[model samples]
Target chain A: MATTANSTKKFRHRVMSAALAAGVALAAPALAYADGRVVVFSPPSTDNYIAAWQSGLKKKAADLGYEASFIETTRDQSEQDAAVQQELAAGADTAGYIWWPFINAAGTNSLRSLSRTGKPVIFANQYPLEGTESLWTAYAGIDDFANAKTAAEMLLKACDESSTVKCDKGLIVTFPAGFSAGADRAKSFRETVDGKLEVLQEQPAGFTSQDGYKVGSQIIPPVKDDVTWVYTQNDSLASGIVQALTEVGKTPGKDVLVIGGTCHGDTSDLTSGHVIGTEVQGAYLEGWYTMQTLHRYLKTGVVKDGKVYAEATPDAPPSDEGDISRYNFIPSPPVGNSKEAVEGFRLWGWTMDELCNY
Target chain B: MSRREIFMDVMFRTGLMILVYVGFALFIPSYYSVRGVAALLDGAVVIGLTGLGIGVTMLAAEFDLSVGSLAALIGVVTLNFINGAEVGMVTAIVLGVVIAGVFGAAQGLVIAITGINSLVFTIGSLIGLRGLALFMSGENTVNIPVQRLEETDFLSASVLGIFSIPSLVMIGAFVLVAAFLRYTVWGKEVLAIGGGRTEARAAGVSIKRAMVVAFAISGALAGLAGAISCVKLGSATPLGFDTLLLSAVTACLIGGIALEGGRGTVTGIFVGLLTLRFLVGGVSGLGAPFWMQNLAVGSLLIVVIVAQLSVRQLKSRHDAPALPVH
Candidate 1:
């Protein structure tokens, strides 16, 4: 009787241990699934470039085994603050936040609100004002000054190639007056080409093809014969300048060289030689690095606040800033006038087809 | 109204338009050139259409703030139908305009049923429709397929060296709307309703039907403008027509359209649009800074309103019976 009772007790103990093992196996996958969540606070997804950037970030985050979500904000600051509050209330174990502030000054309150949550907030695209670094973990975006400087350099090269059109006088069809990015880009272009080139006129056209066409039509007819090169803020504006120049009997790439400051809109202009060249702002790289940084912060619990260079050519880096920056500076290279330059351009592992999905 | 008063009123409104053109022509020599005039007309076509739409609503004692959003929405929708749904350009445009008109009629029905102010109702739609536009286009500019663009190329084609198909369309719309407002019994009922809703209702006018028809017409015209602009641009963006609302309202007011409804002419609205476009194009051509252009527009709006008020006050006093005592 004693032997039988001992055997029964051993059998019950074995059953309980197997059941415990099975439960542990099931909970392991669930734990892995709930590893960490990354929340991205972005502006309205209306812009093609912004949409592309978000898509890249989401793709990278998913690849890195992190659950990523996005919250969109309008131009209103109060609404952004409310969204942040709502996100914080509903989220748990939030690894970090990727923030793209729409307007710099109005975005400070949003930054302050996010800072109180003790989660690292990564500011992308628009750089905030100085002394606001405490509110964000780091900044990641195209250096507009560098971008404009690159455009100036390209314009100078184009002028040097031609003998008839001296690089002395040029026209700048600018973005709106007070916008920080436009202001910085215009200022940088002027400063870089101050002694080398004489800017004939700088007109502040709002950032649209229509506005560009309007301003270009008004200014191009009068200045067409005089100006050597036209520097537009983006390809959309560059296309407008081409149209206006055509209307005035001037060929864009022939009579006057047109430099699209950024590569956006249809790339057919680049292939057809309407736009001489443009700078690749590395939007995809900016997004990929943003996600990678978030994953690193989650794993290490240490934020490395420094520039990241994800460029096409490993050898050619931005000459202005050497590899010794504390903040991440993604590499933005200039594409030449040839179709090969556009087709051959690559960032990290992604091709132009993947980068410019818009 | 005496013939002299009528003539003076016509001169007062249209005279301002003529003076603006002459002033720009004199000061800015390039403003008189063919290219300059063509550019002005090209810029005015879209806004002029929107202004006419708003003018129609104003004539019926209603305001359609959703015209701008409707324009953007319709443009995006038309492009989507062509690109995403693979529909023919003509079919897509007609479908887009019809859908916009239906939406407008629905809003009118809501206003009629609930007795809500048209302004408030359209303001809600303005926000909602903009949101809907963004959603429909996924917040990007929907590009029309290259093959489909040839069908709509007439929008950009110059017909008479100075006029494009878009400009002709604007003119046709203006003439059609003017004739409709002047000849039809429904048009007269709309005017009467605007002048005095209580009296119109007492006289057995179909207020609900007239309001719905007026709003539908406005929506269809706005949609047509959007479709034309989309073809011209070769793409349709969700926020492309953001500035249309303020500009259209300013054009209506400057054209001597009564804000309280019951008064305005299509010809006057067209002239007002031309004046505004000339000011914008002329100032930019003359090297005026961006801020100055905005200031000029704002100042012009305020000056017109204040001057009209002053004139009305003077006329009322002049018409008052003479005092009995010294």
Candidate 2:
């Protein structure tokens, strides 16, 4: 009687295991049928930043039942184009939407072309010039020119008031001043400084800190005493400028004020008083918004919100904000030294937990 | 002076001096002051030293493409030893030198034992060594703290009233190497071996030993060059000396060092390096478009190579028998 009972129990266990396996097999196809993917394209050199951004995007993508991957280009237009083409080709098979940090104008066109294929494309942290509006569904990034103006004003304020020195008449080591973004920063800076500042020297330091250091080390030592500011085109350049200045025995804030745009993680030196300020980009918020927009677009297939769609002109500019979004001219709040710099980080809209997602 | 000899010598010497002076003169006006020239010189020293290593190797009809990556590895090794540590700079430098020597010996062994072409072998090593550099740095930039060197008064201080210390070092290294090649017996043996390997061996020279020594010196010097550059830049990147191989090789070539080997002076190499320096300074100083520099270098290289090739062709033609008039 005992042997018969044991045999029946063993038979029941096998039946339950088989039923559970069958249930999973039946549901697997439905999971595979879900159309959810987010594509991020960034410069290969900015892999560190993209990696950090994607880690955050992945968490949200997972919670929302979506997929995300990133492609990195080495700052070359052709290389960037190759990355985009590869992603677009793959996206045709398994893509819900596309996201990109356009390396330049041509890259924007590539993104626009991809968007025409009925896929939502998000231009993250860079906007196209006029007449390039058919590019993407939405744009997410801080205004670069505003960041430049804020940097210029803060630099002028940091200079010695009694010295009769104009911060504008200092060396401007910037990126190659060819693109709309770099050109905008250069123009805004020149306008803010007015005639009081003379650009003694302006050279392209590329966008990397190493490039900035190479340009800065050569320009700083002999001119540091007379130069009131070592203006960089961006935050990474500013970090390099500071490192170069420090190497030459001139403390950054004490010897020469450093100012630039783009507050990537490298700007942590500002919190330690090693650098002055930079325009911080809200990377996390941008990533989250991208996923949210992509999800909605894939589900509803709508391009614009209700009333905005009615008022939209085909020729409307590709601005991150509309004419109604509070102040069409956004301010890149100054990331001053100390607590002010930390406050600048608040715009990222990421809790400490989310920020650590990278 | 004999007419034929004087013409040939004048052509050579004039070419050499003009190249050197023009190299410096072009930068003087644009830099606006002597101090700017001095700073430019500092950066040039690092390249110039590596050129010396390449110059010596080229003299022996052999090449070592691994020197570039080897330089970076040696630099990071030096930095790791010295960074925020109680170890003295001299001790760290010595360790770097020893390690570089050992690495060079291994390369020398491969070339000597396998009979494989140095070009292919070193190219493989170059890729492998670059990977090692990236792995060591965890693919991050390593910023060397200059404070210790600065505190010891060893780091380069103010640019001289007329020239910078690094530039001065470059000039001194060029002179020292020039003197060594011209005045030393070992230099003659190098020339003999390069001119004809069989002849050099028959003449009682230890060809294998000489080759090994040359490789060792080349590697050690390259290592030193990378370290100096790290000190100057205050940081080291995994990209390392790869960007500099072109400049170093070009300097050696334009300096009148023959690709066939055993045919150049260190002074000629100096002229070549200066020419490159001028190219960089002129384009950057004149605020010309950056792409123009590449064009300028390309044009200058073409002009030099054509001139040299033409001279060789003319000499061969002169040596040939004239056809008798029928």
Candidate 3:
């Protein structure tokens, strides 16, 4: 039995050598690891708010002497996982993954699978799920909670102007779904708006413009005049609400102020008339920083813990009590008054320099 | 053509269209206007183009569930190739059309060789083709560059002042197909085969060849419609044809194209498309919430179908001979 075991071990070693020989046979000229080809897996397409980030990342890749190609997976979690598998199958060695979780639950499992390859995994719009970051580099575009706080502040101001009391009666519409950022936004918005204001309605909009319209329209029918503002999670839903109000012959801003996030081009139309105020998600910067961090991690094993790579929560500070809540929280500049806000938004994102460096 | 036959056919289809349009108008206030009619026509042209192929295939007692997915695949593939090549818009469109024909031919081969039940086969084909498209496109939305396509004027511009060029093209295609199916020997064979394959075989018809030709033609037409739509949108999305299946099926059904096969018309399908368009336009123009419009369109389809079937049943009852006092 001992002799047989030894022989089996020898046979396995021989097979391993043969496989190595076959691999070398297939490729005589193995490109050096520094061939400077970085494969990027973007969960959302270049068309979404993330394009700014992609553009920045491209510039950064060029600076780093890395040619990069991005593949979008339409933010479908299962499909995104499949996409990662496809990329690995297509020979994307030394690849970096930048993901914006479509739903919160999907982020952990998907990232964990990718991290199993021991490649550098980067997060653009989401946080690391507990143990997942130990295997990968995690970075964010902006502080989701801070942006939500900014959005809430903007809404409060709008509500105060129309309200009879010092604090306005506000209705916050959000999704019940998971996603650290989405949940953070809703939680922060409630925390900021609560007690100071009369909460009129806080129904779910289901992360879609159609839902925003449906829920917004439903709420509009009942309120006589006390509802001072309508706050939504995104611009699409904001547009839906605005459309509903316009139908009822009531001017949005004049009757009640509306506020939402996503400083997209579409939101500009709504903000132009002071119909709504928005907190832009800095996608470009997020992309640039994500790639920058990964490149740094690849070159140097050191992960920059103190550096404010992206936004962190102010309410819940880091577990290490000595550490400050450090984050690269780039604030979305206010569009000023209703008249000036609509003139045109820059669609705030990372500059070319930031992207290429990352 | 006999005057009575032409009159009856036109009246039957046209009447069905008007009734559906009017019924929707009752629900949506804006549906009664000229703009609503125009909207219906625009939608009809887009959906009807594909529905025409479906209608034809239905008349032959077969189905092509892959039509929608195939259209999306062709649109995305053509746009990617065109954009990648930096080719002229005209050349791109031509290439798109040719590629579409090739895709159709591939599907035709499967049906011809396998002799599988088309309904089951097409369902599988639809899922597979859509998966292939999604994979190929990397799940990205491709903007159509509508302005560039619009410059062609002949194909993209509104013609005769009110009708869209694409819509006109769709109508022309319908007439051509209708004529070919009704007047040509091949057309007679298709009708005969659909009516009764056993009878057609007895008459010495080449069943496999005819069925293959019908499926191929259906697929090619769907591809053409998808390409044109992509050009209009200035972008192609994997979800571009998401509505294609439901709309095609609904339009075909409403056009009096029996799912059981051996009965339907190009004109009826065209009218059905128009009716759906008006229904959508009217509700949208009236400014209903986004989801409500979808709900209205869906429920309205069921109502319209039931109403038409009911009316046909009533007419049959009326035509029955009176019973004697036995």
Candidate 4:
């Protein structure tokens, strides 16, 4: 009797395993599908900011409906077109496209493709190239020029206040050639600091702390005496600048003022007082604004050609009284020092954890 | 080869390197300083190791275009393995280097058996492996925890205000690679195969084995280069390693390494790397734009290669017998 019972149990287990395998094989295609209403295309997650962006997006997306979907790709214009084409071929349920391109395709040629979609498309991370604003419904991201201007203000302030070092001589380390944000920031910083600050050197580097460290080690030794203030376009480079300065027996906050123009990853430099200051530019808030703007437009059915800057807070309703045609950027708020970045500093009612890091 | 011929080439390459060094030092006062010299070597560390590795693979008349992708992947994966997988740093680094070697050997085997062009095969690996790295890392920078930052310092910290662990490792790699290629039977076979595969095969050299070993060495060195860089930065991002491929190719060209095959010594590659680094360092030191630095390196590479070809042609004409008409 025991042998018969064991055989029956073994036969049932085999049947269950086979059934489970079949179910998974069938479900894979359904998992890949992104369609019917709002479609967001983003790069695959590599940093906490990306993860935070997705979370912020989903929280907003959940209120709208299940029709909101997300697709992951690191593609340019043609590839994005192909993806949209595939969606249409498979009985297109997508309402509109929210494209965060890996590269800036902000030109007349790309504008033609976005217009061809015949639906509202929101461009994020890059402002629409000037004179071609009519093609996209809305643009949303940090304003690179404004953020750099803020950085310039912060650096100039540091120079005015410091009794230890002359802020008159400065250098800027920016992202490698062809990166849009880096170019925009460098131009603005140089322009704002003209005559007021004697900008010594401006060089392009890869967007990593290692790149910062390498460039700083090679370039700083030559200009160490003259260069009292350094501005790295992003926070990662700022952290690396600290490492490089310390290695060469220089005190960063004391001897050289560091202005990490835009915040991104690793704020430990700020808390440790290695980096003197950086502006608040959070990915989470950027994501929230993109969805909120797109959602409002889908409801309002308007495209007024201009810029609509997202200000105040994350929970606040997007400024969609009419339609935003061109740009919507996140505000860049400056945090003075480590103490302020860690203590009671607030932007739009959110702490650094929520406004910057999250 | 005559003793004179060997001496002529060695002296010529060394002399050119010194000329460039002196020129840079004269223009940029900092180039004369110990710290400045160390900084120049610091710039060369990653590319120097990558260049030397590819220089070895070139001995067997094979190209490993996958070194850049392999370096980036191995570096990031090593750190990730240690931090995320909770393994000891040494074990993680060793595993990364070993995996890189095995991965390269697999590519070498495919090239040997199929007799496909190595450039094409390695390019495929280049794209595929980079994709794999991005997939693994989620397209982001992987950094060591803040507390671990101090641990990374000893690698870059100046020893007596001169040589750090990284610079030492780079020099050590050049010495070992030069010694290995000069002394070992397998190394001689690699050179022979590069000179003429059919002739080498007739002489009982195993082309397949030689290619495998050269690539394995190249891949292992690239891995170690990546490992050393990670130790210093305490972080890794998977893009930027492609720059090494261009730098390595240019270094080999400047070093008098023939793409057609068997020529040049590891010392020649070192000199080439030094010349390249000094040109770049001096340009940056002068506050010249970045494009000028690239232009200088390109000009140096072209000049050296053209000069080497001219020398070869002159020697061939000199050795030719009198014409029948004469």
Per-residue accuracy of model 4 over A1-358 as CA lDDT, tens digit each: 9999999999999998987786666444344444535666554444455667766666666666534455542222222322332233233445776776443531223334445678888887765555445557788777899989999988888878888887778789997643557778898999999998887888777567888888888878888777788999888888788888887778998899998987767678888777888888767767777777787778888766666566655345455355655677777778867666556666555567665553
Candidate 2 lDDT tens digits, A62-104: 7677666445433433234433433343233455444453334
List candidate 3 stretches off by more than 4 Å. Answer: A1-358, B1-13, B19-40, B144-156, B311-326
Docking class of 4: incorrect
In candidate 1, stretches whose alpha carbon ends up further than 4 angstroms from where it belongs are A1-358, B1-6, B27-30, B146-152
Q: Relative to the unseen true structure, what is the C-alpha lDDT of residue B82 in candidate 4, on a scale of 0 to 100?
A: 71
Q: Per-residue alpha-carbon lDDT of model 1 for A1-358, expressed as tens digits?
A: 9999999999999998986786666445435545567778765556667667877787778887776666664433333443554444333466788887554543554566577788878777765556567778767677788889999999888888976566667899886543456767888999988889888988878656787899999998887778778999888788888889889998778778899898767677778887888877656667766776666655556544555554556334222212222355566678887878878777665555455435
TM-score for each model = 0.51, 0.49, 0.48, 0.52
Show the lowest summed lDDT stretch of 10 residues, model 1 chain A.
A317-326
Candidate 2's residue-wise lDDT over B1-326, tens digit each? 24574356446745754664454443234243554555455546666888887888788777878888887877777777777554666676667777887787678667867878878988998899888886776544454443333432344455455455556666786787667666887766666777788988899976776677667767877787776555444445555566567768887776667787877666667767767665654443332333555677778777777888887788889989999999
Ranking 2 against 4 by TM-score, winner: 4
Give lDDT tens digits, candidate 3, residues B92-204. Answer: 66677677667666665687678888888888988988777767666555533333433433443445544676667788888888898888887777777888889999999
Docking quality (DockQ) for each candidate: 0.01, 0.01, 0.01, 0.02
What's the C-alpha lDDT at position A108 in model 2?
41
Off by over 4 Å in 4: A1-37, A66-68, A74-91, A106-114, A131-135, A206-208, A266-268, A271-273, A313-322, B1-61, B66-326
Of the true interface contacts, each candidate retains a share of 0.00, 0.00, 0.00, 0.00
**Looking at model 3 chain A, which ten-residue stretch has the lowest summed lDDT?**
A317-326
